[model samples]
Target: MSQKVERYYVPAQSPWPIVGAVALGMIAVGAGNYVASLPDGGGYSGYLLLAGIALLLYMLVGWFRNVIDESMSGLYSAQMDRSFKQGMAWFIFSEVMFFFAFFGALFYARMLAVPWLGGAGNNAMTHEVLWPTFEAVWPLVSTPGGTTTEAMGWGGLPLYNTIILVISSITLHVAHTSLEQDKRKPLTIWLGITILLGLAFLTLQVEEYIHAYREMGLMLSSGIYGNTFFLLTGFHGLHVTLGTIMLIVMFFRVAKGHFTPANHFGFQASSWYWHFVDVVWLCLFVFVYVL
Candidate 1:
């Protein structure tokens, strides 16, 4: 018996990578300039930011189309599938570290910095000289600069969004199982429900932000508490938006009969991303909202 050697498929050089890099560069520069021009109301940097975003979207669509064509043409081997799996896993790991850094900052502020500023562990002179009036509360509603803001409680919109995300994860899991069982109808229905839940979460979050800004005075400039709160939640919202887009793509592919019970890595990848987003939200609810 002779062993057959499987040849690896190497794709030709593509311009999408360079396009993506340029898009990112433009976004960075545009965002920096826009922020710097905030005092003057606005500038042309906003237009550059929008253009970069449009270019990024174009690159994503083109790159994804090429990959889909290749996959549908049966150009991907088992080795190629394994490679994709590894790449996705590493990408997810990078996201994990990104969130970890934010959480670390939160922990350091809550556990160490705030306490030190409040005269904890023989720092009485430090507190007296720096911010003697600072209360050193967890939410820090009153800043040393005399700016006061209300803390966003864990009730109402936050709680509802938490429940919605939890349900979305369950519905997505059901969709995955239905796909594996070849139950197309249930799969589509559950996936659609999941997408609606995701949309609901995002909508509620927007309302929450509006309430914070209009009524509570909680904003990006509302001292340390507000800064961390917005940074963490805003970045998480961006992730949720991206995850929803991925699910929408998957939904369209499913409608076109793209995935099967046996070979559905694309679906699996999207599911994994959705689950990760759900988990991140749970953590945010606990630490950022509840605690």
Candidate 2:
């Protein structure tokens, strides 16, 4: 006896991606103008940015609502599962590439740029004239450009957050398994715990950011270290926020009996996104903090 493998099903059409693009346009343009107005003492163009973000968020809600309805109605076949998995894989791949870009910058600055500035490559003038005090350190705590910053060590808040996030991933997996077994209580309890862990992680992250800014005097304009640190972790946090929202939505849907064991693409997709974010955080901790 042979079991039939599932194939993916494609939907007829979706308008939300287009609407999302339009929202992105508004946001990008408004952000540009808002920044441009900073020196001139007029930054009110952020209103357009707010509008764009709101519209995009609305679009996401409507679009996901429809998909949830479809899956609950059993319109999604096993074929559709394949499609969803493939789509999530590709999305995670793209995320990997995005993080790679930041990692590439980190590597270049560490292995090449800093060393060159320290006269590692026969650039005597660079070291002697430009950077008399630079020593080509890995973290570059003190830059040749005269910016000083304290690097975060790999203990305390970060380690705790790491353990919390790992637990979150485990709880989420258990919740998914509960759903498959049609056990509502365990699913709700586990999902609720996962959400709380996520919120705790975010709270710790914000506190860390505040500590960096206040106690350490590190800032966005501090140096390249500050730049890369904030960019990598900040963007990862944004993704986590989005993932948490998705998880909350799925939590509500599950309470309403929206997904069965055989048809839970939305829940699965959100779980995949959360794991992707978790992996990204690991990379950030290694490169940005520990390494």
Write the residue-wise lDDT of candidate 2 on 70-186 in tens digits: 776667776667877998899889989998999899899888888898788677678778767778787766765677888887797888888888899999999999989989899
lDDT of 1 by residue, 5-102 (tens): 87678999999999999998998899878756764744899999889989988998899889999999999988999999999999999999999999
Q: Note the residue pairs that clash in candidate 1.
A: none
lDDT of 2 at 177: 94
TM-score for candidate 2: 0.88
- Find the candidate with the highest lDDT and give its number: 1
Worst 10 residues of 2 by lDDT: 35-44
Q: How does each model score on lDDT? A: 0.91, 0.83
Model 1: residues with Cα > 4 Å off, grouped in runs: 35-40
TM-score of each: 0.95, 0.88
